[model samples]
Target: MTMAYKNVIHGLQKDEGTKENLFALVFEQGMSTNAASIKLAIPRSTAYSWVKKEKEQRSAAIEASEIARQTAQAAAAENLKVNLFALVFEQGMSTNAAAFGLGIPPSTAYSWINKEKERRDFTGEASSKTAREISKEDLKENLFAMVFDQGLSTNASAIQLGMPPSTAYNWIKKEKERRDITGEASSKTAQEISKDDLKKNLFALVFEQGMSTNASAIQLGMPPSTAYNWINQERERQSVTAEVTKETVQETVKETLKDNAEETVHETAREISKETSVETSVETSVESEEASTKDADSVYRVTFKL
Candidate 1:
């Protein structure tokens, strides 16, 4: 008999007005259409079409869920970006600093700022900054001064101020792009010299050569405040090195003293032992000589009496 007939004999087939085994076999049992069709006594085409429809439905459901998850993530990310921009634009935080505070990368922060700037520029949106934004303006002015007056590269300036390199580079680049449409060459250094040389010189003059901060600042042609700031930061870095060296030196001195003390004690003990040994040997030799002389005298006396 056919498997369909066997299925009917075994009561696997549903009676009239009951749930059909064709769908049950494919859906619940995960059977292939050919197996389900044979087992449920149904046409192969019917089983194939049902399975295809179920597969498409599941695929559409999965796609919809994924889109919803992405939408939620985007919304959350937008909120974070708003806070990041507020820090950069209003509070004068560097883009990298803001990004770090928000647990993001420097490049992502730079990209977001650039995109925002482009959007604002395209729309001609001149957002007014509060009084707090003076710092940002000051930063821009100082960066430009470094670029135009000091002949320093944006990278060097950024390093000097502990700001992100990309932020400074892009700021200078954008300013140059704006002025390119107008016209004037900024005096940025061609060789991109590291302004850190100034710091090194300042430190050498003050810490190494015993010069005062004022004298170092004068010699370096840097402002007194800048000199102090740089020197103070350097001092913090060197403080750790000094502390470790101090501990190492203390331990070395202690070990040397202990070794020297032990050697001195051992030498003193050896000298004392040698002196005691020599004194004891001399006394034994003198006592033996005295005893031999007495015995010789007594033997002569006894011979004469006999």
Candidate 2:
């Protein structure tokens, strides 16, 4: 019916090998009809017709391949999401940092974090019915067990135990503080060093030792948040102190310059007055000598006349 169909029939009659080659190129190799036409030196219309028929024959296989490709892509994306989530929640990485590290978009990573939190809240609410009434001490013990033994995040453990995340965090903080006070904490920095010594160490580590905030925090056995807060406050205090010191130094310099300027002006005025007095005295002496000489001349003239 079509020129391509006619070409196919001719090919079949002339040589089956040519027809097979066309099928192999268009079907097995997945070459486009136009491309196959050039490769096989066949007519474009013949190639199109052969490719169309081959597509119909292999439609199921093509559909299956596409589905497989989509599934694989979806699986890879899910794996990436899981890894990023773990990095943020389990490993204490910030969402943006984790996203950047994993080459994920920050907005997408934030959405995932929100979804996970929502899921956790829903699960916590659903399981609240089975939540047992326990003493504060028992709850604290369980929280510690979940965190230390099972390696669960504080938020995750709080959700499992049907407690608010803030409450869990506060309880943990208090416990740590109590342990530190009793010298039972494992951190040598916290247990052995006094508060003043700890502050000095933190300052030296960051400013004098030229360490990063995180590294300083680690060396001081303090939470990064706490370390950052201390560093920020210290910087603010130092900034204020520096401003005060600069003002004081500037004032001192001004005072010193002012005194020197005043003393120089006084000395200049005294020198000018001394010079004026010396000139006045010399002029008076010269006038007195001239008057005496005239009187003597008059006296001599009078004597001569006598």
Candidate 3:
């Protein structure tokens, strides 16, 4: 057609084709070197070289590209995974809780949780440092209602809640200690911790500051009857303590008195015995002015023994 050709064989065009002649059989027919070579009656090596040249030229057109975007995306994913791990395992938060905090799906969080479980089981490592904070609500509401409001023992509360009694006890003990250490800075308000806490405060105001029960109740935002009852209990407790102290003092005094009297008697007897043990001799010499029969003398011996 254009008469511009790349290669020729005798009088036929090699890179050009007509109805009676064909060229570039390997590419035009989409044939492999083996098939094209046999079809075109050419050596297999010649067909292979043509295919190789095209492959090299096409490959040469491609250039290397920077992958910073992809690297940053991968790093962000890794960081998310690390944060999820810390919240779920290290902080003792549940999968759903950690997921909610991270704004991730709960299903994804649970999947990661299972994967971590398996990894830790295989590796024999533990990540948790404390019990879950979510359980504090159990202590504040459920356990408090059962033990204080319903008059159930701690063990009974545990049974009702389907947890180990020791777990409940430890949680309560630690919570109380935490509250004691932090005071007003505790996670819960004082009344939320226990209504009795408010009652005790009311009683303290009444007894310590001599405020009336009505005034204390009003100040503490409690019912007057409840405040009065708590104040009465506190007074009764103090009365019992006073009675015990008085009895103890009386018994101590009696013992001391009896022991001192016995000791005084024993000491007096010892001193008297010691004084009597020494010798007391009285000798008198007088010239005999009147003696019976001029050589007769009378002598009397006086002796006192203790």
Candidate 4:
């Protein structure tokens, strides 16, 4: 036998000192531990412990007598505190509460409860089935996966999952923009937003061409306000249109000056024609006077000569 067993056996040995101590007591005469405990000043617990040591020779015998009796009595209990299911249905205990009382695994208890529900369903006992609640984390993960992996539209996902289309779109848009609650851009948003080819094309057509927001919206099949917002956002990116408004203004001014110069030339030509006509009239008058004077002089000379 092991050392512990030997020690226990040794402790059970009858001892003269214990007997004498018991005899000195008022009650401990010939009686066993229980009777001696009643009569003697020594404690009944001490007396019983002594007897237990003495009875070590009959180890199995003592155990078979009291321990077995108690064990059997406990086993004979009729109700025996039913398991989680019975407690839940018959005693109205919650699954969690029942699980706690029974020391069974909570998951197991919950499974049992669910099984009970399924049974009720099969039997047409329960009126309706409740949908399992979705958590925020679950929604975030699913939305991310749907957008990235499945290539599903946000509105489509919302329709499928019975969520608000706007909410789904907002989540996707926010993630694409990388605008975190902290006002910082996340890498995921930057990547997703960049991947939107439609957005890129739309911005190019709108801001680059100076296309009106409504026209751009019609082309892109989006709201005008949305197109306007995207045009503003395009400005944040590299310059959409290379030629500035200053260059256009300068070109327009140059054309205007050229037109004005041509009109001025036409007016100057008309004034020159009018001045030429007046000069011709003065020359003709002078010519006529000179001719008459010449004729008179000639006549006078002829008379003198004669």
Count: clashes, candidate 1: 0
Tens-place lDDT per residue, model 3, 1-306, is 334442235235543332112235555766567877687676677667767876676566542223566677679767878998887556555566567778888888788778877997677664542333444453456775665454445655675565557766876677567757977334554435566566567767877888899998778655566667778888899999999999999999999999999999999999887766542211111233345334433332222221
User: Native-vs-model 1 lDDT?
Assistant: 0.78
Runs in model 4 deviating more than 4 A are 1-244, 294-306
Candidate 3: global Cα-lDDT? Answer: 0.64
lDDT of all predictions: 0.78, 0.77, 0.64, 0.65
Task: Rank the models by TM-score, top first.
Answer: 2, 1, 3, 4
Per-prediction TM-score to the true structure, in the order listed: 0.37, 0.40, 0.30, 0.29
lDDT of 2: 0.77
Candidate 2: where is the Cα deviation over 4 Å? 1-193
lDDT for position 268 in model 3? 100
| Ordering by lDDT | 1, 2, 4, 3
lDDT of 2 at 277: 100
Per-model clash counts, in order, read 0, 0, 0, 3
* Poorest stretch of ten by lDDT in candidate 4: 128-137
| Best-fitting candidate, scored by lDDT | 1
Q: Score candidate 4 by lDDT.
A: 0.65
CA RMSD of all predictions: 22.3, 15.8, 22.2, 18.4
Candidate 4, number of clashes: 3
Q: Please, what are the lDDT tens digits per residue for candidate 4 over residues 1-306?
A: 999998877765544555556644423455556666676555687777767665574677878788888887566422333455566665544466567777767787778688778887798865643322224446666776766555545655565554557777887887756646666553454335643765776767766887777887678655566567767776755453435566777899999999899989998998998999899998998998899899989999999999
Q: Which pairs, if any, clash in model 3? A: none
TM-score of 4: 0.29
Backbone clash total for model 2 is 0
